[model samples]
Target chain A: MAASTIMKKTGAALVAPVGWLAALIDPPLRALQKATGLNGMAAFFLAPNMAIFGIFVLFPLVINFAYSMTGGSALFLSGRTYVGAEQYERLLTCENYLDKRSCVEDLFWNAAGNTALFVLFQVALMTVVAMITALILNRELRARGFWRAVFFFPVLLSPVVVGLIWRWILQRQGLLNYLLHQFGIDQVLWLTDRFWAFAAAIMVSVWAHMGFYALILLAGLQAIPKDLYEAAEMDGTRPARVFWRITLPLLMPNLIVVIVLALIRAVQIFDEVYVLTGGGPGTSTMFLTQYIYEIGFAQLIRNPGLAAAASILMGAVLVVLTLLQLAASRRNQNAGAAK
Target chain B: MGRITLDHIAKAYGSVEVLNDINLKIDDGELVVFVGPSGCGKSTLLRLIAGLDQPTAGDIRIDGAIVNRVPAADRGLAMVFQSYALYPHMTVRRNMAFGLENSHMPRKEIEARITEAARMLEIEAYLDRRPGQLSGGQRQRVAIGRAIVRNPTAFLLDEPLSNLDAELRVTMRAELASLHARLKTTMIYVTHDQVEAMTLADRIVVLRGGRIEQVDTPLNLFNKPENLFVAGFIGAPNMNFFPGQVEETLPDGLSVSFLDGQKTPVKAATNSGAAMGAVTLGVRPQHLHLAQDGEPQIPVQVRLVEALGAETVVHATASGGERVLAVLPGQPAIAKGDRIALSYRRDLLHAFDGDGMRLAGN
Candidate 1:
C-alpha cells in the first residue's frame, strides 16, 4: 500500500508539468478551433510538412520545367535565352529514330537506347532474382535470419560504395580475374570491353537493388496464411500447381509494386553504374541519367536546358509507370474486397 | 476401404513432445470425433493422418497398406480447416474445382463434381462469388463443398464449424450429420466442444495433454468416463466433484463419507482386495435433486440461482466450501443464502480412487 501511494505521488509529480503545458495551450487552441473549423485546424497541424514538401519537391520541379524551355550555358534563368521548345526539338531531332549516328544529338539518342535496354534487362533480371531469393528465404532453413540479413545487407550500403566494391572485383586486374587466373584462365576486360562493361553494369545494379525488392516480396509471401497452404496440401496439390495457383495470385499485388518500383529505379540508374563503368569503352554503357549529368554539370560548357528536357521526359515515363502501379493496386484492392 | 490404422504414432518437435504412443484403428466409414481442450495435440494428430505432417515415429496405414511415405495429395484425403481456408482469390466454384483440376481430372468430370457438390451444399447461386463476398456460413459451406468434390477416401475436418455463430453452428452440425449419412465416407473430426462431439461422433476419442484418455461411444463416455478428467470434461455444467473417503466396503456397494460429513452409498465395485482409503465422488448436476427427509443429504447454502424457465440451476456452497451445482427440473424456490440438502440415487454416483481411475461398476 505504501509503494502504491508513492507510485501515485510520482505519477502526479510527472503529470503536473504536462498539465501546466496543456492548460497554457488549451485556451488558444480552443479559440483557434472556434475561429476556424476542424479542416483549418488540420491544415494548421500539417503546415510544417507541407512547407518542406513544397520547397524540396514542388519548387524544384517548377524550376526544372522553366529551365527545360530555355537554352544557354548560363547558371541563372535571367542570363539564359528563352528558346521555347528548342531544347526539346534538339533532343528529338534525328534523321532516323533508330540510327543514333544519323541524329543531330547522337549521344542523347545513344544514351536513350542504352537506358531503354538497361531498364528492360535490369528490371526483369532484378525482379526474377529477387522473387527467387524471397522464395528461398521464406523456407524453413537453418540460420534463416542470417541468410535474410545477408541478402538485405547490400541495401544498407551507399550506391557509390556498392559501385566501387564491385568495380574492384570485376576490373581486368581485379579479384575475379585473379581468381580465374589461379584456375588457369586468361584475364578478360570486364569494364573496358563494350559488351562486358554493359553486362557488368546490369549485374552490379541488380546485385545492389535486388535485396530491397526481395524484402518486399518476402513480406508479401509471409502475409499468405499458413492454413491455406495446408488446405492445398490436403487437397493433394502438386508443388508446381500450388505455386502457380495459390502463391502467384496472392503475391500479385506485392509483385506489381516491386516491378513498378524497380522499373522507376532502373530508369534512374546512374550513381552506382557511373562510379563503376564511368560510361566507358566508347560510351557503350552511357545511360540517359549519365548523359544528363554529363551535359548539365560535367561538361566544360553546360547545357542545363537540354539536360532538363531529358529529365522531364524521364519523369513523364516514371509518372506513367506510377499511374500503372496505382491502377494495378486499385484493381487488386477491388478483387480482394470481392473475395 | 479407408480403414486407417495408426500404430504407435508419436510426434515431437525437437525435445518438446506433442503426441506420444498413440494407436488406434478407425473403421471404414466411421465418423470418429477427437475431442479435447486446446493444445491437446488433437489437431496435430489429425494433420499427421492427413499427411500434411509426418509422424516422428510410427506407421499410418490406409486400407491395408503402410502409407507413411505417401505425400498428402497421394494419400487421398480431404480436410476442412477451422478458418474454412477457402481460396479468397477464386470464385466458390473454382475453389471447389481446384483439387480435382490438380489431379488432372477431365473438364467434364470436374464440372459435374463441382455442380453436384454445389447443389448439395445449396451454394449453387453463390458459386460465382468469391469467399470474401460470402457470409461466414456460406464460406463454411463452400469449404465443405471443396472437400466433398474431391471425393477422397476419407474426410478430415479440423473444427470446421468453429467459426460460425452459435445458431449457424447448430444448423451446420445437423447438415454435416445428414451429409455424413448420405456419403457414408470415413471422417475424422476434431473439436473441443463436447456437445458437438456427443451429437456427431460414432465414437469419441477423449485426449488430454497429448495422450488418449478414453475412446468410446458418446453415451458410454457420458455414462462411464474412465477417469476424473473425462468425467469433468464431457458434461456441460461439469460433473460436480466432492472430496470423499471410502468408509466401508459393502457386498453390493461402498459407503463413502464426504468432506462435509455427509455419508453416501455409492454403487461401485473395486478391484479385488484393492485399498481405497481416499476417493472422489462425482455426480452430474442433472442427477441431483432436492433431498427428502430420510435421504443421503449434502446440505448447502445457495449462493446464485440461474432460473431458465423450464429448469433452474442452483449454485450453492457446501459446508466444506465446495461449489455445488444442482440443475433441478422447473423453477425451485431457491435463492441466495437458502440452506437446502441435495441428494442423488446411489447408482448414479461415480467413485474414483486416489489415482483418479474410476472404480468399476455400472
Candidate 2:
C-alpha cells in the first residue's frame, strides 16, 4: 500500500510539467478558436497540407497542361510558344484508325494499341488470379501464416528488383533455358520473340503485384460472415451455384476496386517492363507511359510538348473510366437499397 | 417423418471434450428444447444433429435411417441461425426461393411456395426488399420463412429469439409456438433461457458441463429436478438452499434438522436408506411465507425487501448466516432489517446429498 502511494505521488509529479505546459498554451489556443469558428479552424489546420499539395501536385498538373498546348522542345514555359491544340491534332491525325502504321504519329499509335491490349489482358488476369489466391489462402491449412507470408513477400520487393530477377531467369543463357538444355532441348530466345516477350511482360507484372490485390480480396472475403455460408450449406446449395449466386455477388464491390486499380496500373506500366524488355522486340511491348518517357527524355531532341499531350490524353481516359466505375458502383448500391 | 435419435453422442476438439455420451430421442412432431448455460455444448449438440458437424462418436438416426454420414443438406433439416443469416444482397422472395430453386423445383412451384410462406409470416409486403432494408423482426421472419419454404422434415433453431428485444422476444415466442402447432413438424431448439424452453418445449433437456442433467416436461423439470444444478438453473431468483442434517428416517419421510436444532419432517418419497447424514434443504421462494402461530419456523433478519405490487419478495439472512429468500403473497408490511419468521409445508422442501444429486423423491 505504501509503495503504491509513493508510485501515485511520483506519477502525479511526472504529470505536473505536462499540465503546466498545457496551461501555458491553452489560452492562446482558446483565443485562436474564438477568432476562427469551427470550420475556419479546420481550414487553418489544413493550410500546411494544402500548401504542400498545391506546390507538388496541382502546380505540376497545371504546368503539364500548359506544356501540352505549347510548341517547341523548350523545358521552361518562358521559352515555349503557345501553339494551342496542334499537339492534340497531330496525335489524332490518322489515315486508317485501325492501322497504327498509317498514323502520322505511328509510334504513339503503336504504344496506345499495345497499352489497350495490355490493360485488357492484365487487369482480367490479375483480378482472377488474386481472387483464386485469396480463396486458397483463406482456407484452414497448416502453416497458414507462413503460406500467406510467402505469397505476400513478393509485394514487398522493389519493382526494379522484380524486373531484374525475372530477367535473369528468362534470358537466353538463364536458368530456364539452362534447365531445358540439361534435358537436351534447344535454347529459346525468351525475351527476343515478340509474342513471348509481350506474354512475359504481362506475366511478370501480374506476379510482381498480385499479392497486394489478393490481400485486398482476402479482407473482403473474410468480412463475409461464416454463418451465411452455413445457412447456404443447410439450403443444399451446390458448390458452383453458391459461388455464382452468393460469393460472386457479395464479392462484387471488392472485385470492382481490384479491376479499376489494376486497369489504371496496367496503363501506367513502365518501370518493370521497361527494365525487362526495354520496349524491345521492335516496340511490340511498348506502352503509353514508356512512349511518353522516350519522347520526353530518352530520345535525341526530346519533344516535351508531344509527351505532355499524350499523358494528358491518357489521364483523360483514366478519369472517364473512374467516373464510369463510380457510376456503376452507385447504381449497384441504389439497386441494393431498393431491393 | 422427423423422429430423430442420438445414441451415445460425444464431441471433442482434439483432446478437450465439450460433450460426452449425450443420448436423446425425439418424437415425429414434438418440439424438444436443449437448455443450458453457455459452454454446456447445447449448440454443439444441435449442430451435430443438423449435420453441420461430425460428432466424435455417435449414431444419429433421422426417422429410422442412420444419418451419421449424411451431409447437412441431405439430412433434410433446415436451421434458423441466431444471426438470422439472410443473404443481405438477396430480396426476401429470393432468400426464401433459393433452396427450392437449388432443388430444381419448377419456377411456378417455387413462386407458389414463396407466396404462401410470405402470406403465412405476414411478410408479403417486404418480399421485394433485401434483408438490409428490413427491421430486425422482419429479418427474423424472413429467416424463418426461408426455412419453412424448404419443407424440411425437422427445423433446428439455435437461439433464434435471443437477438430480439425483450418485448419482441415475448411476442415472437408466442408466434413460434403457434407456428409449430400449425405446422406440426419436429423441431429441436437450443437456448440458455429456461423460460423460453419452458414456454415452447414439449420436453426440455437440461444440461450442465455438457452432461445431461434431466430431460422431462417443463413443469416436471421445475417441480422435480434430478440434480441441484437443474434446480438452481431452471427458476427465476433461484431455489434457496440451507445446509442441514438428516436426524432420522421416518416411515412417512425423512426428519432433517437445521443449525438451530429445529426438526422439520419432510414428506418425501424415500426408502429407509435415508439415514442420518448431511443434507441440503432447498425450498423455492414461492413455497415460503410468514410463519403462522405455533408452527415450525426459520428466524431471519430481512436484509432487503422488494414489494412488487403482485407479490412481496424478502431477501434475508438466517440466524446461521445462510442467505434465505421468501416470496409472500400480495402486498404485506415488510421493511429492510426487520426480524421475521418464515414457514413452509414439509412436502414442498427438496433435499440433496453432498454430491449435488437430488435425493430420491417424487
Candidate 3:
C-alpha cells in the first residue's frame, strides 16, 4: 500500500474502536440523564477516570497499609503473619524520641533525624534561592530563556544521574577541588567526611530542585497584574515596599506550595543522596528511604514489615504537612477572593 | 503647582511607535481628559505624564521643572487605575497609608490624611476591610481615596469609572465631577468613553493613531470638531457623512455637490484654502429635521426605528448606499421601509477637506 493509503487505513482503524465505544456507551448515558433528572452525564464522564485513579492510587495505598500491618518476609498479604501494631511499636521503640542512639532501630532513627535536618535546610534554602532566582529571571533580563533553561535543566535529570553528576563534582579530585587548587588551597574531603558529605548532599539536593520551585514561583509572580505594580509606582511606593505589600502577599499561596512540596520530597529523598554519599561518611546523610532500603532489601535480613511501617509514618508526616498547607492555602485564597 | 507640560513627547517599543511628537500643556487645577478609542495611546500619554513610562524622545515637566529622568515614585503624582489596583491583601487604611509611609511622613499626619480623605469619599466604614471585601463602587471610592490622600501635584486617572455598573457609573461620574471641582488639582483622565470625556473634562484631547486629532472644550468639540474622526467620535449617534467635492468657491461661501447628485450651496461666512477640494459634509443626527415643503430635501429609505422614550432614532439609508441616522425628537411616526425626506441647515453641516481636517469657517 502507498504511504497515504496506509496512513488513512491506520487513522480509520484507530478511530473505529473509539467511535464504536462512543456509540455503545452514549445511549445509556443519555437515557440515564433523562431518567434521573440529575447530573448523570457528569457521573458517566467521571466513571472511567475514577476507576483508573482507584485502581492505581487507592489500590497501592491499601496494599501498602496491609504490608505495614503484617510481620512479613512474604510479598503476598495472605502468606504473611498478621502483627497488629507490632511493627509500628518496633519502629517507635526509643528511650527518647530525639536521641536516635536510644532507639531499637538505631539506623532508622538516625535516618529519621538526618531527614529532619535535611528537610529544614532544604526547604528554607530552596525557597530563598528560588524566590531570588525567580525575581531576577522575571525581569527583562538578557538571555532570559537561556537562563531559565539553565536553571531548569537539573530538574529534568534523573535523581540517580543528578547524584552521579554532583558526586563527580564534589569528589576530592573533582572540578571544585581543581578550582580550589587554582586558588592555592589544600584539597579538602567533600564526600568522605561526615559534615562535608552531609552538607554536600543538602546543597546538591537544593540545586537539583531549585529550578522546579523557581518555576512555580515565577508563574505566581507573572500572574500578578502589571497594573498593581504601576499603581504602586504611581503611588510613589518604593520597590521594596511594593514587593512586601503586594508581590509577596499575593505570592503566598504559591510559596506555601513550594514549601510543602519541598518538605515532602526532602522526607522521601533516597536515590541521589544514596548514589552521591551512599548514606555514608558514617551514615551522616542517610534518610528515611535509605533506612527503609537498608532494612528491607540491602544490608540486613529483609524486614519488609518494619520498612513498611517506617514508610507509612513518612506518608503520615507528608499528609499532615499537606493538610497544614491546604489550610494555609484556603485561608490565603479566602483573603485573596475578597479582593 | 500641578501644571504639566509635554514637550514633543514620543514613545516607541522597538519599531512600533505608540505615541508621537505629542505636545500639550495642562494648566494647574484643570481637568483635561484624554479620550479616544483603544490603542490610541491615551493611557500611554497618561503614563508619560505620571512618569510611569519614559518618553522615548522628549521632556515632561511638572511645575515648570523638568522631570523626564525622575522615576514614577519620585514624580510626586498619584494615579487611579482602571482596575482599582488596590493592594488585594492590605486593608483600605493601610493601602492609603502605604504611600505616605514610603515618603516617611509622620504616623499622626498619615492617620489624619487617611481619616480626612476617607471622610471626604464617605468610605470610613470600609477602612478596615480589604479591597476584596468592598463592593465595586466602594472599592472605587477607596481607590480614589488612595489618590486623594497622596495630595500630589497632579492626579492621573485611567478610566476609573469604566468598571462600574451603568447606574453606579453615573453616580460615580457625578462624584468624580464634584471631586474634581472641590480639589481643583491638575487632573488628566484617560478614557475610551466619549461621554465620560464630554461630561467630566474642562478640555478633552481626542487622539487617534498615536497622534492628537483635536483638543478643545466640550462645547467646542461638540459644535466644531477639528477633523472627521473627532466629529464622528465625539457624538453618541455619529454624524452623517456625504462624500462630495467642492464645485465652486463663491465670494460668499462654497458650492458643493454630493456624490448622489444633490447640490447644496453652503452659506457659511468665507471659504479658506481647505474649502476648495474633495470634501466630506458631516451633519450630526440631532441636527437633521423632517423637511418642510420649501427646504432642501434628502431622500432616505428608513431601515430601522428605535423609540427611546423622549426621542426616536431612525436609522435610514440615503442615496448611493450611505447610512444615515436621524435622532428626531419624540416618538416619530416612523417605521421600517418608510421613504422620508430630511433637511439639515448648511451652517450645522461640518465640511472636512480631503485630508479629513475640518475646513475653516462654519
TM-score of 1: 0.96
The best candidate by lDDT is 1
Give lDDT tens digits, candidate 3, residues B1-362.
89999899999989999999999999999999999999999999998888878889988999889999998878778999999988887899999998888889999999999999999999999999988788999999999999999898888999999899999999999999999899989889999998899999999999998999998999899998888899999998888988988888777777888947778776444537677778888899999989999898898999999999899999999877899999999987989999999998877888888899877435
TM-score of chain A of 3: 0.86
What candidate 3 gets wrong by more than 4 Å, as runs, is A1-84, A96-98, B267-271
lDDT of 2 by residue, A133-206 (tens): 99999899899899888889988998899989989999988999999999999988879999999999999999
Q: Return the candidate ranking by TM-score, descending.
A: 1, 2, 3
Q: In terms of docking quality, how is candidate 3 classified? A: medium
- Name the candidate, 1 or 2, with the larger DockQ value: 1
**Model 2 lDDT, residue B116, Cα:** 90
Count: clashes, candidate 1 = 2
Compose the digit string of candidate 1's lDDT tens values, residues B28-135: 999999999999999999999998889999999999889889988888888999999998888998899888887789999999999999999999999999899899
Q: Which residue pairs collide in model 3, if any?
A: A338-B132, A339-B132
Per-residue lDDT tens digits of candidate 2, residues B1-362? Answer: 99999999999999889999998999999999999999999999999999999999989999989998999999999999999988988889989999888889999999999999999999999999988898889998999999999998999999999999999999999999999999999999999998999999999999878889999999998888878898888887789988888888778778889858888877655573544688788889998889999878899999999998999889999998999988899998989999999998777788887777787444
**Best of the candidates, TM-score:** 1
Quality of candidate 2 docking, DockQ: 0.61
Evaluated on chain B only, candidate 2 has a TM-score of 0.97
Please list all clashing residue pairs in model 2, or write none if there are none. A339-B130
